[model samples]
Target: MRTSLQFIFLLVYASVAACCQGQEVTISPDVVYGHKSGLAMTCDVFTPEQDANGAAVLFMVSGGWFSNWSPPEQTQHMFKPLTDKGFTVFAVRHGSSPKFSIAEAVDDVRRSVRFIRGNADRFEVDPDRIGVFGMSAGGHLSLMLGTASDEGNAESKDPVEHISDRVNAVVAYVAPTDLRVMAKDAPDRLPAYDRFPALEIDAKSATADSPIIFVTADDAPTLLLAGAKDDLVPISYSRNIEAAFEKAGVTSELIEFENAGHGFGGEDAKKATEAMVNWFVTHLDK
Candidate 1:
């Protein structure tokens, strides 16, 4: 269930004092999380001087799954809030679509979770407290991470594959819930929509791997924020997921901005960010 508008503002204002008191942060260069299609899938890590509550946040910043990753400097501002909360942040990038699909992106995120948790001590993080966050297609992948996490395979020769990929929490923005509804209602908003008809991200093909279909009570606690007027990936994208989470008795929330659209910014962005911070704090800090 969603929080009230007053609660959102109060939560934001009240939590401002809980920040890490302007702690400095250390950053990591692009480190490989996985290798596929002869490409190095990597991420940048930001570590607060105070060790960030001994937890790490995995950020998937891909837009429509086509990521253009740069050095940590270019994206530092985005993670400042998390760092202020004393949470290490990992900006994760995945292979693009058209050339790559949602399936690969899903694998990339799950693998990143395993990689970060597997190296938690080296990174000075709590292996049990990794939380995933993203917007749009990235958010969709984050949801997949929440719904499809698994204990690593003991039989696997690769250690990373043997490390659990489950995250404690998720914060998603404007993400599609069902690829079937997404493709049918607004194919133009989907990645590689030009070939959507032939793509496997539909109802007839929706599998346990598809995020929406994959959800269960075991899914991570999630906070979803969206714009009521978003025509691209409509608020229904999140609403449907909210319903699914409720049906499965998963802890989830949805906030719909009455006056907003696809681009969530200004005051709405502040609220969304605050909601995310509160969600992470409540779910991860424990």
Candidate 2:
């Protein structure tokens, strides 16, 4: 029994070592986005290989519209696991809603991708093959990055104003796609906010800015993973966006988990992760 256990340990170590060798891992944080009062967003860049002209993924963290919790270790589950599979990953953070409006958070994510793409050579990443992924609100942001781009200016001095942040592909896990619908019907499931003055579903450009509203044939391919039982971010979120994707003749897919909820764990979550990885492999790993 002792010998068997030792042999298994040795095998695991060897596999992990083999996967990690020749891979350069960098966890750079506080990548400044702008200069305001305490005005700087942070992200951790995880570069896995030196020779990787491969696609990179920006993994956005899932906090609700309210700005309270920092992204925890579980947030790493989406990106770090992908790094071992030979991809560069960036964990992006943005100011939360209420404290910052949806417009502000959207712009923050857009700027983060632009910064990563602009520094592609420095990071050994492929500029044209970047992808984005997130869960819940972060997922919605990821999809927005893929769909909405009126072609941003790339020559400004403002770090946030200097580039187009469009991505090649997107993966969203139980994200709110139609904020108008969500804001109206989802408050019961969402976090109760007595302080931030609950926003109206129809308020301030949510309809026009929704990922579902922006889908087109020119949009990037998308992979949406939703839990059927997700109360906070209903399965209807993915369905609405998918309907729009099909109408626009864009390539996108939604994988629904029968027994999962808003946030998943266990075998169901693993399957969802595998599906997401395969989606990126198909669309962005070319």
Candidate 3:
């Protein structure tokens, strides 16, 4: 039997492929954003053919901390909802786990943002209006960008490093907020940690990687969508982050699909996608 997470992934993929047919968008595939250990890190840029919005959104192409690549043309349908609304999208791939740790993945994504922001003019996007969206491990990465961003290193030699990584808004689905719960010796440690070596960490390291630890008043406005029936990442993760956002006076909302699992399908999928598009429109379209 497939796990809830796996099932949801397939369902969401099939639903998106089925509904997002014939979207007119220009795709620039494998644009190098940065380099890691002499390897080029890349993102596929999707620009709407009409009504091109200056704002940009980065989609973290990660699942279970494993960043995989597919032909941009094959996956372009997945971004139709955002493109239909005239939002430019960048599908960002981070360094995969088993070879890279969660901490390294975070660093890779942060660098990707810096590169995109520094080259915003080339991409025809507003540097200050960037947003991010992801699901599962990707969602966790999105939250990391939202809460732990810096104002850029002015003295850095690389021009890209001089641009801030902070995003204007965030939308995460079923993200793990407090990674400390996955500490190796924790009583409630994730049961499948062995399968995702990225979660193999001590309590101290987990705390360092947890998005909840970095939340502050100035963090990006965030929208979290979660399935109440999610078995992989409990709904409490989103609930806790929502509470933290509220306490910090940040604009945030959490929408729960009571009947869905780790991923949404059918009406729930449509609702979540709409909610995501609207959140970016309200926050990034200023």
Candidate 4:
């Protein structure tokens, strides 16, 4: 058993180190996806071989909406399943909040997706076969992208900005779909939120931008995963989103992991990862 586990580990490690097997892996780290106030917004791109499946996954690495000047490398291992399965991944890091408001972070993520889609040929991915996945605050951004995609002005000089930001699919792990509802769900958190500048807004303002308000039949297929015990965001957020999706007649699902919290662990995480891969495969091909 130990040997089998070791072998699996080695296989994944080799793939992560050298890119997945169809063609040579081309890793372009810190590729600037956008420019914000003289600052460059970059994403780590992992491209597969030419004979690849031609699908792409945009993975967001955000927590607490706090912008990080440096994009983290921790995402590579977590996304190997998608890469190995022939999906290119763009590990997108948004302008963190507090230092940079969540609104800016939302813009950065949308711009990154446009950048990826704009350069789909260069990135060896299909422009229309894109998916976005994120956890926590990252999940919030992911949801916003799905609910709020738009095509840029075709007359714009910037080619990247001129492209559409719509994705084929979206997967949000433990995301807060409605902050207004979340605030009401847990009034005790008000004190903590009071310390923060941007999050201290009234419920109406928060609800105005929540993903639940944006549900439409035209929205992309989405999968919302939540742990039953997640006190931070709560499963109710996902449940409410799931209900909205159904009301809108959009393809959507909610998966609640038992004995899990804000993040999944051990087998739960593995299953969630597998579900993400399956979702992309199921939707991207169609």
Name the best candidate (by lDDT): 3
- Candidate lDDT scores, in order, read 0.76, 0.69, 0.87, 0.75
- Taking all chains together, the TM-score of candidate 4 against the true structure is 0.85
- Name the runs in model 2 displaced over 4 angstroms: 1-24, 49-53, 66-78, 154-160, 184-201
Tens digits of per-residue lDDT, candidate 1, 1-286, equal 0112212322332354344446677888888888987889899988887756988898885766666656677556567778888898898888776577767777788889999998888888899898998777778888888887889899998888999999999998877667765443444545535443324455554454457787799999999988899766789778888999999999999988888866465577777887888899999975
Which residue pairs clash within candidate 2?
none
Instruction: Pick the winner on TM-score between candidates 2 and 3.
Output: 3
Output the lDDT of residue 221, model 4. 97
Indicate the worst ten consecutive residues by lDDT in candidate 3: 1-10
lDDT of 4 by residue, 8-49 (tens): 222333344344334344677899988877888888887665
Candidate 1 regions exceeding 4 Å error are: 1-21, 184-192, 195-203, 206-209
Off by over 4 Å in 3: 1-23
Per-model TM against the reference: 0.86, 0.81, 0.95, 0.85
> What's the residue-level lDDT of 225 in candidate 3?
94
CA RMSD of each candidate after superposition: 6.3, 8.1, 2.1, 6.3
